[model samples]
Target: MAERSTADLALTLTRASRTPLPVQVADGIRALIMSGALAPGDALPSTRFLAQRLSVSRGTIVAAFDQLISEGALLASQGRPTTVHPSLPAHLLQQVSAAAPDPTAASTRRPASPGASTAAAPGRPDPVPAPAPASAPAVDLRPGLPRTTRIGDAAWRSAWRRAAAAPEAETGGLTGLPDLRAGIAEHLRLMRGLPTDPAALLVTAGSRDGLELILHALAATRGTLSIGVETPGYPGLRRVPQVLGHRIVPLGVDGNGLRVDALPTGAAAPDAVIVTPSHQYPLGGSLSLDRRLALLEWARNEDALIIEDDFNSELRYTGAPLPPLSAIDPHGRTVLLGTFSRLLSPDLAVGFVRPTGAALLAELRDVREVLGVRVSATTQHAVAHLLADGTVRRHTRTERLRLGRRREALLAAMLDVPGVRVLPMHGGSDAVIRFDTAGSHRGRAGADPEARAVAACADAGITVGRLSAAWGAESQAAPVDPSPAAAVGGVGGAGIVLGLARPADGAFSAMLPRLASALATVHHTR
Candidate 1:
């Protein structure tokens, strides 16, 4: 229930016909047309009607309408009536229209598909939309904890300045920066507790890009390769290896992270294992130390490569920093992949990969250059400076505290609303909450009661990424196991992952009552 905006108002005014009044008339019309006072194709009152209403001569109203028409902004006609031009002032139109529902619907014979290209949508403002229902639904608290607007302008400015000043050659076109490798190696040594040589470091566009490079490098390394991916684990995360023709085995993860003891041997044993040891996503949990030790042993015993995704390692709030699996891999069998997206921001487009040995590292670097997957030296420099200046590290400390408190508040408010259980947020910007039906762990079906809750929330103008979207949106997935003993899991009830980071200040504080009211009347239906 949004209040009418000022843009919805119309203008009622007249001017003397003897003198030119272009500015006043334009301003008046602008206010009306921009405001919804006059909609597209909506007829305007006759000149005489406006003139009499404004206590001015009909000639003046005619002159104003004539001027508006001449500017190609307003459509004016005597018998047919006049209205705002459908396409004038494109920017302002986008602002209003971005919020409008399928404008093309009226003209089409049938409704267009949601992803139809014929549908028109314009670019949004640079800053993330205000959290409290702006022109659109607010608070898209989904998992993956994407904080698109989290990166401060100061950091962007510095990064941009460095990027703008650096030579293009430094970005793997030949003029490489040895100092960057040195600094990066030192930083990883201290922060990630990984001992590595500077020459082994190769900057990558992202962790996924790093993964792609690994797949490309490993494509023919050993005879037929099969990799293991955690089930319901980051769907987009496993696509790189799969597209490269590697067979994917589904590995189950519980509270201990990926079950190392569950590694299938013989043909089932994967040549590589991808695990997010530091804050496992979806089902948020850290890898237990014993499991971490076993994972190292599994890789060693099976003679496999372990891909450790240390994404979002810096924002740990509940416990001390856990050592990455790579830190414990003494046999040099693990390839460590990480990104600044979680800690710094996603737009930075910077990630790094640490290989096990100098030979593997050198080979990957050569492949990286051949494949053109390097980040610019200036970006590396800017992040280095920010880290050196203590801004990024300092920001991490503050955001962790703020996010922890906000996460708690969001969880409390959601829990108070009947049928909603807020999943704890121990590691990232979002708090995943489940409602309506039961979790997928329960062997039941038709738990669509959760969908009723989602529908109620949608009616109140909340947009969320649901459990189904998260599961099926990605193109690649771990293979389904058909073991006779394997229990078929049910799809979790309508679950909503709410991001505490995106809400406008105090928006979460204000949304609880509206949410609770909606939930109060929600009930399951077939």
Candidate 2:
């Protein structure tokens, strides 16, 4: 087989189409392989090269490549060019060639349904099993998902019954139901040790919506602000700002969470900074006391707003939980974002934004009046009932114990996996594992052990989060730096972010050995 140039692939991508660019790329490559245009041993263009040729983000190309690799349609090893799987049966290639549809009649042909399968002609091997149906993973280890099944059915029913019995309000009002606000204020005071006025908190759809509300309010006063976000931070929160026309300045994090010293000054200073002080996402490092103080001081000096996402703070398994930045902000520069998504259920679509300063509170209120209330009166009342009756609190305590056991199990399972280190995570619903990509464990020039580990887990009916994905698209185009400071500016090290909230206790325990085995395989292969 001749070595193919980057242009030889000639992938056609339609931006206007509903399908994603990565899927289009993967489908094109798969078609080429099936048609024998790309032979069994034919090498493919590098992701970067192909991304450049296609005028798409390198991350897009990487996703396509990863999907192909996972489907066994391509072969990839550390430091070598990706190639068509050398073991693809010759008969399959011949069969596809013989059955090739005419380009002239392509538009006239009906597309096959996603689940439709072609029966094998004569005695040909079944078409590679169609890459496993896109069903829910038997063991889902993705982060941000909480175990909602643990909530007592009695408590759940009682909360809703109370909500249903309450006199209906014409509107949830601009800031949300007064009762819900009061309930949230009390909940925060008791649980998070942050005393807040119910009037100061504005109801939002969730944390992301809370963030959007903050940005909208802030942007109303200040035009497109430069917002500092932790590198390798939660993409869900990061995307909210980006989509709202704000510029994102990537900040680095370490063992103690967001690096205070790295905060840019002068012209580079951000107008606002978002931090997960209680428990950082993916990395699971809480901001240290010193760093928290420093961050508050920096915010005061720079006159920058601090957005604290206090999601999953109550789920900490070990040690006393730290006070939220909003609780300690003496200058009233912080706005706290909270959500029922992690503690209760995401289906509730309920959360709140509490600003420390009276001025900011007024600003958020004014913005809310203009935007109108999003949460329904019924939902707000339901959540208020939950909080008022201590159901939420008791449920939270139970979930903490349940999730703690899961976290401990995850730790115990990975303890003996060679070349893999599960980073210490005190709270939060997820844990991170860094791969030993250097020294003797360094596989090949370009091998990504973290990616391979994730692929292996996927092959075993387990789905896990990729650490590299947290760094955004640019990181995906190339190899991760794997340095402690690699994520200083959104670039990150190689690892997997394992969510501990999905599988049941027994199922999770059963999945751990499989997960550990996958890690071991990646290590040995490297």
Candidate that would win on lDDT: 2
TM-score of candidate 2 versus the correct structure, residues matched by position: 0.71
> Which regions of candidate 1 deviate over 4 angstroms?
1-137, 167-169, 172-176, 436-447, 469-494, 516-526
TM-score of each: 0.65, 0.71
How many residue pairs clash in each candidate at the backbone level? Answer: 7, 3
Task: Give the per-residue lDDT of model 2 (tens digit) for 336-367.
Answer: 99999778887888999988766677778888
Candidate 1 at 113: error in angstroms?
Answer: 43
RMSD of each: 26.3, 28.0
